[model samples]
Target: MQWLFGSDEDILKLVGRRGSFLSRIGVAVGIKDSDFPVFRELYYEFMEQFKSRYSVYTPRRVFASVDVRGILIDGSELKEYMLFLRDFVNDVVNTSGLYVNFVFASFGTSRISLPGKAKPVSVKTFIESTLKSYFAYIPVWTVIHRTGIKRARVYVDSFSTSPETPAWNELCNNNEVYVVSNGDKVNLLISAADLLLGYIGTIIKLRNKKPDISELKSYLKPFGFNDDRFRIYHVGNRDLGHIIYKDPTVKINPLLYRPFPIVYLIPELSPAGLLAGKDERKLIESSHVYEYILRYVEEQEGSLKIISFTEDFKHLSAGGVVVSLGEHSRRIAEYLRLLGFPLEHLNARELIHLYGGDPRL
Candidate 1:
């Protein structure tokens, strides 16, 4: 296997997602539950040490380091490398600190049911058994400690497939505080504006420390800003989106921009996102419009490669190359013997181990 980038182990470790970003910061700064005052002291000390170094970011390279620890220099491979770092840091936080709890529910057998016949059983038997199991158990303290969110209270509701989410309607009708059902599921209505405001407040809190400007700059470059580009561009949807910017001194222009057609690595699309949101892969796999898009991209002259980035321990049982994009089309020709996709193989076995899977592989 010709290593695609630098050290395979390093790349794999870089992408392993388990921890939380806050825990990573705590570890880096050598702080513990000695509490907020202790954390602030350690944070300042870490900032002072970090400021002693020089950092730089441009289109081709990023350099940042901590004394007596290690240095990272990602050149041209900025996007992938940063992604690895972000995931690693978050995984640390998630494991060492705490993460919000989420529960998934599936409605009963029939998609369409006649009125009154619905028994309204528990979505999962546990919903009737435990308070912790029914609703999303987001720890308010963890959010405050890590993300600096200070939500006063939270309300949860279940939703069904119907217009008013039959579950929510029952709760409202009965005027019940914690009404729940396996049948009628209502939606939990989170206050988006409030969440966004709290998030911004947290960012402001972190920025107030006057962090090493160079370190911040290098950390941000991969999402498309370089020293030469002075302008920024926003594309894609509101929540899951990408941003691009350039510094004027580097002579980079925002106008001459093109988004690379990177392959999406996922186990499967969530049914909720598929039914409520627009997933490109699901749309292409299931619709006639996808055929048109595939034919158009394939007919183009440029060559492309379809890379299968996955884990050896996992498999998408509904195996098929669900989507195709761009001129060069290749598939993991060996992947269960699929064809006509621009294909490259990422060692899924290696990835699984890097993610702390069993040694047997």
Candidate 2:
């Protein structure tokens, strides 16, 4: 119910003060921190609360390009999310500046071209193909320029490429100004989603605090953050469950939502869905995807489960499956194979992409 703003100073002051109140309230809820119970509790409480008070944005900004080395038989599955990986490099370089860091790794699943033999591909192949694919997306480079990203570096598998490959030389040429390989230790390792989420939430609250303020909000404009539908808020202690127990619309469907009984899965959604957006509420709903997503969560007893988003699966049917995906959903499909899930264990999305037709157009 508090007014949200987009100023850093104003937002920081507000969050800095409200931090304690949130800590006490969060414990009352069910949030527990592994290391610093008090600190983690408070930090989450603050983020959720701040999100409630303001808008949060999660941009898939920083990324490593991945290349698929082998052949593919399932055109649909091979190309499903693969388009994003293919164009990702050009997208970053066009949008970012000369000094940004982006790594390229061997990516994609082995099942796209195998006889039930899902081998773990090398990181080198992913990086190589990703850069090679970057060439196809150059026409849209100007559009990215208008969108305000300013830097990019392609990470490569030094062992995978030929001496004469353009990607190798391009990477080598830019080592001083435009690139960083995978092994290099750099200052930024944060998820693009997390950074945008926190940044947007804080900025929105800041704007609300000083309705007349100018400056910080301007930075958001270039990032395309000023749009009206992107509503955010700092989570009030009582509202934390909105993420765990209810949908983004605040609707509850026990059978289809979280905290509901699901076999072999734990539920987690990208925090981006928690913010205001059109129809994004579906991400939090208890559907087949939620079923598998939950099972995956339950499987991760102590490790972190990453939630990645892509339009790759958008072309699929049933909106996709319920299953455990690794850091990348594509990898999850492959990892499941290694874990002994049947080849039929394709995610709902994979099934759709493989056998289902496009419902959007």
Candidate 3:
């Protein structure tokens, strides 16, 4: 049968859960750690060489290396042939270099969940566990199905695993199977994974296809990916209640202009800006509204999913109320304002009552 299904000989793949983009999880096939160092050097070398010949950093020049955001040329036929891979990865896998087969998969937030959880997991735990479950099962899948491969090595792109993973435990029992993490490096394979995932994630972002997986299949065609190996693994979460960005690997580039929201203190709602000596007990008693707003910010703090140029014109209103918890409020607001966010301060009572409810400030 085709490698698409199962293979007869032992096969190995180095893989990583590429990035936790705000919307999806990008998965990449792997390269052996033993050969990664050499591969990484050549990869960067080729990028520099290409940069000298054709600049990729600037889009102002002819051909621009890009038209709008997408590349103007495929460059797939070039002798180097790897320039098609950019954004998330920069390394090259050339003729002399070990060319690790690149396969990719993406699971959107509204689709996949932590194996057992009912809700989409919190960002931190989501990052750690998702890949382990997927990476661990592939070899077992091939073996159980009688794919000819008798042995396999699955290298993962992770730094630590506290409790032993179920797949790791399974591999220990079988001499023919194994799994390992690379301690989270920017080595060749992970870099490539980054590129591949970033490409798909960008597509989802551009299309604004939140909660829809129908168009995802068409994206695989350009990559020549038709095999089950490139499983979309599309699951569904209809009311996913405010998905915070999961994978940090592929996220908004800070250099780009994006709205930076900051939590702020309410003046009229607060009713305390003029108080000289604040009573600690009364302060606590009066600040429950602040407590609620602060709680909301904590959960959604790191999730700046980013807006494209097309969205740049939209008004980004950031003058939401955050309680002045101490000396920190003014400082944080000043810093965010310097970064170009449109922010405003309000009294907790004003903000609360504006929403047609008594803040009880």
Best candidate, lDDT? 3
Candidate 1: minimum summed lDDT over ten consecutive residues — where?
3-12
Candidate 3 matches the true fold with a TM-score of: 0.33
* Model 2 poorest 10 in a row by lDDT: 22-31
All models, RMSD in angstroms: 22.7, 24.0, 19.3
lDDT of 2 by residue, 171-252 (tens): 2343211111111111011112122323333344544432111443454455443233222222222321211211123221
Candidate 3 yields a Cα-based lDDT of 0.35
Instruction: Please list the C-alpha lDDT of all candidates, in the order they appear.
Output: 0.24, 0.25, 0.35
- What are the per-residue Cα lDDT tens digits for candidate 1 across 145-237? 233323222222222122222222232343212211110001111211112112222332344432233553454444222244211111112
Residue-wise C-alpha lDDT for candidate 3, range 1-361, written one tens digit per residue = 1111111111112233553333224443434446556654665565455556655442111111122134334443332333355421333433223322322222334434533456756543443444433332332332322323323343333322233343334433442332212111112333344444445454454444432344566653454443433444432242122222233343322212211243333222233445433344356434445334433333332112112224332333443333334444455545545767665544445544644446565
Off by over 4 Å in 3: 1-24, 30-45, 50-150, 171-186, 210-214, 223-231, 234-361
Clashes of each: 36, 48, 20
> Model 2, stretches more than 4 Å misplaced?
1-195, 202-216, 222-251, 254-361
Residue 333, model 1: Cα distance from true site in angstroms: 7.7
